[model samples]
Target: MAKHSKKSTNLWSTPAAQVLRATDDTRVEEIDFSLTPGFDGTKADAQELLAERGQVLSALQEKLYANGRSGDLRSILLVLQGMDTAGKGGMVRHVIGLVDPQGVDLASFGVPTKEEREHHYLWRIRNELPGGGKIGVFDRSHYEDVLVVAVHDLVPRQVWEPRFDEINAFEKELVDEGTLVVKVALFVSPEEQRTRLQERLDRPDKYWKYNPGDVTERGFLPQYRLAYQRILDRTNTDYAPWHVIPADRKWYSRLAVTELLIDALERLDLDWPAADFDVEVEKQRLANS
Candidate 1:
């Protein structure tokens, strides 16, 4: 394969990751979920742009995979934490689906199984970490230990409270070893969530996608908001920062995530692995054969 040149710039003057990243002072209530921060284009424009960016993203991913195969220790872990109907699935299909499946490792964490429950909260998560040179995506993630567990009082305060620091340490260790953890929380307004849920009930084809528990979860939005605020304030670190993307507009969410993935891969500055054989000798041998 031919070597690809890294792109000097992206579509926006600033990368979407910087535009959407959460800070120590970030308040979930103050963010406008429907607003597209770094993009002024319409949905159609976004769709077109996403198609164009896909090619660049694909090339970079190939480089990452090739480097990994050649003994590079670096990898990426994209943690997506979002409420139901926040477009997590769509982002996966549109953005991640563009890359070579062999180069990506994806996991969707829901209710733990009997086997998963027997171990520590991060046990299942640890097993699913992506190997060197691959993109690992967690659809929902270990934060559920805090967000969902804390919201419903599934565990005592003493149990779930200490996980924030534990998670920070785990991520820092991963970073120190070579994993670039890109954590994202998708913010969707209640009104939009209701509309999306209702559409699932209204359409037969979408019925399979709907979950009854989503409604029950919707009722606890206030509590979830407070919990997420604390998560942003505490778990948002410089080494493994959180990018709170406004996910109300499906197209924008897809585009924003695509850019975020691009940024993560780009920072690696990977190149195609050098051929190990002598080119002239191999060429003469092949020609003679």
Candidate 2:
């Protein structure tokens, strides 16, 4: 392993992520996704920033993996929630995709299977949590139980109400067990989403992504907004914070997420695990052969 200087991160802080991070002081309703933090550069500039940040992210992930290779148990799990066409797939492809897939555990939750419906909502989530030294990304996570279930009235309010506390408790458990949980809500403007959806209809290659149900989902934005507001308010805890990303602009969201993950990984100050074997002796033995 080689040592890499930590210089790339300094350029990535622009479009302040603090405003997007939800805290005890945050008002989720006040968040405006139309203007998110990020550089107002040309497309090329955005690509350059992503490439640089990707390098830093990849290095940090490698270090996290190295630490775990020797038995350290700290890891990260990123929970992403957003409306359809909010760039969740893009985040996976461009951001987390920069790291080694073997070290990354990705799960996308859709309509629950008949079996998943029989157990606690968090059951499947627990199975997918990142192990020691890995990075996990959830395209749509357990929050669906609250957001979709509440919005669609899949479960009664009484049943869903306790879940807010249950979710908080579950996240706390993850943090106590040494997994850093990061929940993100990608805020895509309805107008931008319309444009994306329209593009899918117009482009034959993208038709596969256009689901007629999306038209119905679009009608529930107001209800979903209320659901998300409560979700952010009730579930934001000190141990596992939620970051609301402004996702109208694809480039900015990708940049913001990359910066967020880099910040989290960098704070760990992960060091390369020391070689477990005698390096010089092994080298000499190989030379003799």
Candidate 3:
């Protein structure tokens, strides 16, 4: 197990907080999100990173399964949020693919149904929370209340502003109940996103991923950028912190995520369930037979 040094300083206290506070679009762009250590998927060999991440994920899954059988009931919820072509689906498919399918549930939130829209924003999300001994992956999560809704102005400032607190409370409740929430925002540069979107348009198999609507959304990049900053500012908590991953390099992103998972699971001293035997009862039953 890798021993990570305790985080002596809060992320908010660092220079990253200055970037988060910058509301000016030009100034925000100056913030370097690539400084974090991990796989530089773009420059590094993709196959090597994939193999390393696979091994790490396999270990985590084994520990989780064993812990489940021992009745420890540890739950993990991973929230993946990013722009189109940010590799959210790919991360779920590649990094977590090796995990026992039965032990994990992947929830992808799309357009809300009429029933879902009728209730509070988090109503549908709460229904899908992972039970004890299970892992839940959210392709895009309730953070959208702040991200997309904020970008589109689908809700008023008064309505969405308060959601930050509501979300914090919701996550706190989950963590208090033995749920380990790991929120990840995959950050892909506009240039990289453009390249991926172009590829989607050019490739026959990926054509389905391209839409005129994406161009419309791309126009609101500034708004989404602001919304993303707000998400990092408000939702990052001690119990359920967010990891901002550089998604320009998909392999590096996967490695960083796998390392994060391993780090979390290592904190829980999991062990296989012990065997129990009733020697006297077995002997009596045998004699009767």
Candidate 3 residue-wise lDDT, 1-289, digit = tens: 6332232122113322222222323233454544443322243444554465466567666778767766776788989888888899888888778677877878999878999999988998998988667778999999998888888888899999999999999999999888888888787788888898899988999998887888888899889878987887787777788777767767566666776676566666666556566878988999999
Deviation in Å, model 1, residue 224 alpha carbon = 0.7
What clash pairs does model 1 have? none
Worst 10 residues of 2 by lDDT: 1-10
Q: Cα lDDT of model 1 overall?
A: 0.89
Candidate 1 TM-score over all chains jointly: 0.95
> lDDT (CA) for every model shown?
0.89, 0.84, 0.73
- 1 against 3, candidate with superior TM-score: 1
Per-residue lDDT tens digits for candidate 1, residues 34-147, read 888888778887888888788878888999999999999899999999999998888788899999999999999999999999999999999999999999999999999999
Which candidate tops lDDT? 1
C-alpha lDDT (0 to 100) for residue 287 of candidate 3: 100
Rank by lDDT, descending?
Answer: 1, 2, 3
Q: Write the per-residue lDDT of candidate 2 for residues 1-289, one digit (tens) a residue.
A: 3233344334445534565677666655566677755455555666787887788789899989888878999999999999899999999998998999988989999999999999999999998899899999999999999999999999899999999999999999999998888788898888889999999999999999999999899999989989988998898888888888888888878878887888788767888898899999999999999
Among all candidates shown, the one with the greatest TM-score: 1
